[model samples]
Target: MKCILFVFGIIALLLCATVQAVDKSACSQPHEIGPCRKADPKFFYNSEKKACEDFLYGGCKGNDNRFDTKEECEKTCL
Candidate 1:
């Protein structure tokens, strides 16, 4: 009975480990940038210009000036 319990515990630990290994995500990598970019990044608030304007997004990396829409940018900065 003790041996059976030990086997079951080992199996459970392996199952948990396998599930965790399979669940390892690629979001942290630069290649997977879909989740990093805002859903709508048409405009960003430019602190220098003191207005919301359009700019290019390389997808993964950006500055604090980024915003999803013009209104969202204006709401905070303006």
Candidate 2:
């Protein structure tokens, strides 16, 4: 009984870690500017600085790290 409980606890902890990792995966993406000539301003979470920073984004394909506002980035990443 005690061993079973311990195994269950370990499994729960691993699941929590995996969920958290998935949730934060977008925040872990590097800032991408894409291959365009647009100067649209955007915000992204800087993992190194642990804060949202602004950057000019192209009007094409980019990663999920882009956000329209710093508040939105903070809400998602922080």
The top-ranked prediction according to TM-score is 2
Query: What TM-score does model 1 achieve against the real structure?
Result: 0.42
lDDT of 1 by residue, 1-78 (tens): 999999999999999888655433211212212335454435665545666776556566544555566676565556
Per-residue lDDT over 2-48 for candidate 2, one digit per residue giving the tens place of the 0 to 100 score: 99999999999999989867767889999999899898999999999
Screening candidate 1 with a backbone cut-off below 3 angstroms (N, C-alpha, C), the clashing residue pairs are none
Clashes of 2: 0
**Residue 9 miss distance in model 2 (angstroms):** 24
How big is the RMSD of model 1?
A: 12.7
Question: What 10-residue stretch in candidate 1 is worst by lDDT?
Answer: 24-33
Clash count list over all predictions: 0, 0
Error of 1 at 25 (Å): 30
